[model samples]
Target: MEKAKVYYTDMHTTFRENLLQKIQRLMKSAGIETIDFDKKYVAIKIHFGEPGNLAYLRPNYAKAVADVIKSLGGRPFLTDCNTLYVGRRKNALDHIDAAYENGYSPFSTGCHVIIADGLKGTDEAYVPVPDGEYVKEAKIGRAIMDADIVISLNHFKGHEATGFGGAIKNLGMGCGSRAGKMEMHNAGKPYVKESKCIGCGSCIRNCAHSAITITDKKASINTDKCLGCGRCVGVCPVDAIKTLNDESNDILNCKMAEYTAAVIRNRPNFHISLVIDVSPYCDCHAENDTPIVPDVGMFASFDPVALDRACADAVNNQPVTPGSRLDISEHIHGDHFCDSHPETNWKTQLSHAEKLGLGTQEYELIKI
Candidate 1:
């Protein structure tokens, strides 16, 4: 197979031709104009950071992408699935509020914000993938599934469980409905640790299947009835509910790859990954630690797998910065994510993505 083209640009420009110009160039080189966007619903998936975390991609970057979509006559909207963790982005209402608070409003990005899954995260369309290893079908958010095009604007960064959250993570894990996310994260029903339960009934209220029962000053989950949406786990006030670790990290990454394929199935898609603000953890965390590396530039590609592979290679080749979280860790390696989190193997995401026919890991990095 021919290597997919992954266009890149470094942080080497003055105010005259800044990163935004580079972004435009990168997208053009990557063939962003190839898609027919007239009258299309373009869903630009992105992570709006938890309110206090400052490491997420700036809304200006989103505006650049939104402008490109608008220029093509696409009706673009910035979107993300409601997070499974208890935080400001747990539901559509609060998620939009956090997005607006963080400057991702229509005025800033030239598009409205929509929680891909509806109000309580139950709105989904089951997409069948007959060749899937872990999941035969993926429950994607309704708005996301219904869109004519899917564009991922990812803030490439380190992750605790997935090694790194790049394009595959963005689509697979990011695009899944609350229940689909649960399926990718765990292979079984989620449980409530009664000892940690505050009996606040937050989990009960969030469970779409009504699997959680609260009485006697505690909450207990009925496994038989639970669909394992994982909303309960995120809604608990005290972190009482938890998804059991039934799947291996390798399997989880593979499942994520399959789910990602389900998301882009039969749809025109584009991807862009920003390697700046290389946070040591996912933006889901309220607090972002120091960056592990210097600001690498932006990457754009039609092939998400190749885009991620190129980004990971770029980060691996760079020298680690001193006084960062990566520097503090005694055991070091060429790969920053592995050096920071030794237990995770990030390659599983790419290898599995290839297996699912999402795209090839083999890529040619074309510098802009």
Candidate 2:
């Protein structure tokens, strides 16, 4: 495979130019304008940091991307799918509120925020994967799938499960509907916490597979019958039902790549990643620790695999921040992400993505 081009710019700001302007400049240099945007509906996928976690990207950066899309004659909307976990972003209403609370309002990003999956996280589109080994069809958020073009504006950082969350993480795991996430993270089954079940029967009512049965006013999920569509998890008012996060991190990474392929395949796509706030954990966390490394610059590319590889290389080259998790963790492996997460092997995602013909890990870093 040919080496992909990954554009980069340092985190240097002059009195005449700010980071936001630099982002716009980088995107232009990366050729985001090359896509036909006339009357196109563009999905700018981004994470609206879990409420209380300040590690996510600022709204201004999104505006920079959205503004560019509009300038190219496209209709852009900031979008993200609901979380599979119990959090402020688990459903559309709460997800939008969290986004607003985190400053992704229309007034801030110059575009409206849309929870890709509908109110209950049940609205989805099953798109077939070309050469899928783990996933046959990826359940993607309806709103994202409806878009004519896809743009990922990612906050690149460390992840416990996957060595790092980069462009693929944003588009892959981030784009999956609740059920799709279950398929990626588990073998399609969930257990009910009887103590937490209030006999509300929300799960029973939502279970299309008749996998859930209410006994003694408590819910019991039959693993044999359960399809793991994850609808029960979405409707359970008390959050008593939860999917087992039992997939190996390597499998999780590969599934994430496959899900991402289901999203961007046959669609015009672009990517941007800001490697700031280099947190040692996902932004899905409610609280953020000090950055593991000094803030690296921003990156943009048409090839997500190369973009992630470039960003990871940049972070690994930086000195660990004092008093941060990377500073405290025993640095056995030279790779900072591996040092931070000893059990995880992030290379699996990139290699699998490359195998799927998503993009090559080999890249030419073009500085703007």
TM-score winner among the candidates?
A: 2
**For candidate 1, what is the TM-score?**
0.92
Give per-residue CA lDDT, model 1, range 237-285, as digits (tens): 5767777666877888898999899999798999999999899899999
Q: What is the lDDT of residue 103 in candidate 1?
A: 95
Q: Write the per-residue lDDT of candidate 2 for residues 129-148, one digit (tens) a residue.
A: 96989998899999999999
Poorest lDDT segment (10 consecutive residues) of candidate 1? 228-237
Report the CA-based lDDT of candidate 2 relative to the real structure: 0.93
Q: After superposition, how far is residue 123 of candidate 1 from its true place, in Å?
A: 1.3
TM-score of each: 0.92, 0.98
Q: How well does candidate 2 match the true structure, expressed as C-alpha RMSD?
A: 1.0
